[model samples]
Target chain A: MNSRREFLKLAMAGSTAAVAAPAAASAQAKPKRWGMLVDLRKCIGCQACTVACTIENDVPEGQHRTAVPVYELDGPNGPSQAVLPRLCNHCDEPPCIPVCPVNATFKTEEGAVVVDAEQCVACGYCVQACPYEARFINHKTGVADKCTFCVHRTSVGLLPACVETCVGNARVFGDLNDPESEIRKLMAQHETKGLRPEFKTGPNVYYIGLDDRLASTVAVGGGARDLRQGLETSAHGEV
Target chain B: MPAVDLMSFDHEAVWRPWAVAYFLLVGTGAGAALLLAYARLVRIAEAKGALIVAASFALASGLPLLADLHQPARFMHFYLGSAPGSIMWWGSWFLPLFIVSTLLLAFMTGRRGNAPMCGGERMLTMIVGALALCILGYTAGEMSVVAARPVWNTLGFPVVLILTALMSGAGATMIIDSLNGEKGEGRYMLVVTGAATLVAFGLWMLTDTNLSTLAADYAPVGLFGGFIIAGVVVPVVLAVSAKASLLLRGVSGALAVFGALAFRWSTFNGAQLMSKTETAFYGHEAALSQDALRTLAGSAGLLILSLIFVTLLINLLAVRASKQTQA
Candidate 1:
C-alpha cells in the first residue's frame, strides 16, 4: 500500500515536469524552422499526397490544401510527364499576411503559417494576395483556410499525413533548422529550386528536377514575343 | 522550355458584385458630396437641390457596405479590434466620419435660403469636402495596395479614381442644375473634370502595361467611345454652342454619369478575370444568383428611398422655418 502511494506521487511529479520542460525550453530555444522537399523524379503522378492531405485536414470537396499539377513537356526524346506538387510555400515574405485587414492569418513561432478562424473576417483579400494560389475560403467554416503543414501533428512530433502516406517517399518533411535532419541533408546534397524564385518570397517548399515551363510563371525582363513563347496551353484544365 | 498544359484550380473570389456595388456607390456618393460642398462654399444658386441629392447618396452608401459583410452584427469589431497596418481599418474610421459630417452639413443648410450662411456651416461644409476626397482616395488605395493583382498595384489607381469621382460629381451637379433651371459654374466644372479624366487615363496607360492591354481588350469599346463622344465631345460642344438648350446639356450630363458608372464596373469586374497564376486566364462569369440579384436591387432601393426621404425632410424644414418667421 505504501509503495502504491509512492508510485502515484512520483507519477504526478514526473507528469508535471514533462509539461513544464517544454514551456521552459521554448523560451530559450530558437523556434524550429519547418519546411518540405519534394523529389519530382520519384513522384509517380498518383496524387496520394493530395488525397491524404484532404482527408487529414477535412478539406472541403472541390477545395484542396495541396495539389499535384502534372505538366507534359515535349522533350527532345518524346513527351515527358513531370508532376509538380504545389502547396502553400510558407514564404518568409508572405504577401498574404500583410494585406489581411484583421491579421487573422499569421506565421507561427514554429514557422508554420496558420489561420485563426475566430478572427477571420472572410474578406478574401488573402486569397487574392497569395502568389502561389495556396489559399481558399472554407465554405463550411465561412473563413479562409489553407495548408498549415499539419502543425497539429508537427507540434507533437509526428509526420504530416501526406509525408506519412506518400506512396513513392517523394515528400520529405523535417526541421530545416536541424543540421542532421533529412531535409537539411537532402538540401545540402542536391540543387533544389523553389517555384517562382523571381518573386523572391523565400518559399520554404523546395523542388528537385522542376520543369522550366513551370518555373516561367513569374517571367521578368522578357519582351512581348519572349513572354508569349512558353504559355501554358491548358488554361481551361482543372487545377 | 517547351510549351506545357498546366491545370490550375479556380480560387474563391471573396469580393463579389455586392462589393463592386459598394465601391461604385461610395465613390459616387463621395464625389457628389464634394460637388455639393463646393457649390455651397461658392454660394452657387443650385447648391440647395444638389445638397439634397448628395446628402441622400452619402447616407445610402453605408447600405451596400454593411450588406457586403458576412457578419453585419459584428461590424463593431472593426472599430473595437482593428489592425493598425491595414488600410481597411482606416477606411472603417474615414467612411463613417465622412457620412456623419456630410449629414450635419446638409441639415444645417436645409432651411432653404432662409438659413443665413453661418461660419459654423461653412466650416462643416469644408470638413465634409475634405472627408469626401479622402474617402474617394482611400477606396482606390484599398485596391491598389494589393500586390497580388498587378492591375491594381500602381500609384495611378488612386489618381484615376479621384478624377473619375470629379467627373461623376460634376455630372451630377450639371444634371441637378439643368433640371432646376439654375445653371451656375456647372459647365466649367464639367469641362475641367473631363480634361482631368483624360489625363488620368493617359497616366494609367503609362503605369500598367499588362492592365492597359487587358483594359483595352475587355473595357467596352462602345461605352468608352460613347463616354468620350457623349460625355466629353458633346458636353464641350454644348458648352460652347451658340444656342445651348437645357435638353442638350441634360443629355450630356446623363452620358457622363453613365460613363462614370461604366468605368467602375469594368475596372472592378475586369481585374478579377485576369489570371494571377501563369497558367491561363481565369474565366469569371458574373454571379447571377437569385440572392445576388435581390441584394443588388435592395441596395438600389435603399438609395432611392433615402433620396425621397431627404427631399421630403428638406421641404418640411423649409416650411417650418417660414411658419416660425411668419408667427
Candidate 2:
C-alpha cells in the first residue's frame, strides 16, 4: 500500500513538472511583449480598422478578426454613442493555449497568441476555451483561426494593419516591454481596463473610456437578437 | 448619425452532436473496459461474452472522435505534437493505451481456461484499469478546463461522468452475460448499478449547489430529473424487486445505458447554450443539418459493426484454440 501511494505521488509530480516546465522556460527567454491600447474616446466607429484587418489577413467573408461594436446609451445630453472595438486580448495567461490538443495554438514570446494551420486538428477546443470569444474555426482552412496581432507585420517593424489604418488614431500599439513605447506611456498615464477582467487571463489589450453599455452587456450565447435591438434604440452615455 | 455596429461573436456550435456522441461512446467504452478487467482479475467464467463486447467498445471509441475532427488526417499529430497541459492531449494518449491493453487482456481471457492469465497479465489488467479511470477523468477534465463555460468549469462534471460510467458498465455487463440464458453474476452487477446511480444522484445534488447558466433555467430541471427517473429511480427499483425477471433486469440495464448517453447529450449541449461574454449574450441553438445527422447515424452504425466484427474474430480464435488442443 505504501509503495502504491508513493508511485502515485511520483506520477502526479512528473505530470505537473512536464506541464509547468515549458511555460517557465519560455518566460525566462522573454522578448518584447507586444500590447495594444484602444482610446474609446477617440474612436469614431468608422470600421476602417475592421475592413483593413480582414483585407490584410485575407479573412473570408462573414468573419472578422477585429470588430467595432457600437452601443447607444441614454444620456442627460440625449442619445450618445460609444464605439468599442474588440479583438483578441492576447493574454499573458491565455486560456486558449493549453486547451489545444495538438499544440496548434500557442503564445509567442512577444505575447501574441497564434494558430498553426497545418498542425490544427480543428477539434475546436481553443474556440470553446477562450473567455473573450476570440477564436473561430476557419471554414476554408478547416482549422481554428484567430488574430495573430499581425505578428507578420509587427515583426518586420511595420505597424499592425488595424493600428495603421485607424482614421481616428484611437489605437496605440507597441512593445509593452519597452518603457519608452507609446503603449507603455499611455498605460502609465491612463487607467485602462480589459474585457471580462474577472477571468484573470491577464489580457494585453487595454481600453480607455470603455462604455458601460458595451462593458456591462452579458455575453449571451443564443439570446442576442433582443439585446441587439436594445442596443439600437438606447442612447449612448459617457464612460 | 454613427452606425451602431451590432456584430457579436459567431454563435456557431463548435462541439455540436459529433462531440456529444464521441463523449458518450468514450465514457461507455471506458466503463465497460474497467468492468471487463475486474471480472477477468476475479476469474468470472460467465463474463466471457461481455468481455468481448467491452473490449470492442473500448477499441472502437476512436471512431466518433475521428469523425468529429475536421482534419482526420492530422490525428497522428496528437502523438507527435501533443500539448502536455491539454486535457485533450492526455485523452489522446490515455485512450489508445486503454484500448490496446484491454485488447491484450481480452485475448488472454478468450483462451477459455487453456492458458489463464498469469501474474504479468493480471498486472497489465490493473494498469489498464487505472488508465481507464484516467480516460474517464480526462473526458470530464476536457470540459471542466474551459473556464469560459461556467457550467463545465467544475470538478462535479467529472464525478458525474465517473459514477455514470460505472453504472452503465455494470448494466452492459449484465445484459451481455444474460444473453446465453445461463445463471451468471446478474444480481451482483444490478446491486453495483444501483449503488453507482445513488452516488451519482448525491453528486448531482452537490453539483446544483452553485448553478451556472448551464445548470440554470430548464437545463438542470431536465438533466437531474431525467437522470433520476431513467438512471437512478428506475434501475434501483427494478433491481430491488423480488420478481425481477431477466427481461425486466435487461430493461433496467438498457435504461441505464440510454441514461448514460442522455447525460452526455444534455451536459454537452446544455453547456453550449450559455454565453461566455458579460454583455447581452447571444442565444445559440445547435442546428441539426442533414449532414450532421447522417454523420451521427454513421457513428452509431460503426459501433454496431465493430461489435459484430470483434465477436466473429473472438469466435474464430476460440474454435482454433479448441481444435489445436484436440490435435
| DockQ of each two-chain model | 0.25, 0.25
Cα RMSD (Å) between model 1 and the true structure? 7.0
Clash totals, every prediction: 2, 26
Q: Is the docking of candidate 2 incorrect, acceptable, medium or high quality?
A: acceptable
For model 2 chain B, give the 10-residue run with minimal summed lDDT.
B278-287
lDDT of 2 at A213: 50
Model 1, total clashes? 2
**Residue A204, candidate 2: alpha-carbon lDDT:** 91
Per-residue alpha-carbon lDDT of model 2 for B31-123, expressed as tens digits? Answer: 766776667667544356556656777766787788778888989999886478888898898888877887776666555445555777678
lDDT string for model 1 (B151-262, tens) is 7787766776676666666666566667777663456666777777777777777777765655555554422564456555566566555135776666666666666655
Instruction: Tell me the whole-model lDDT of each prediction, alpha carbons only.
Output: 0.70, 0.70
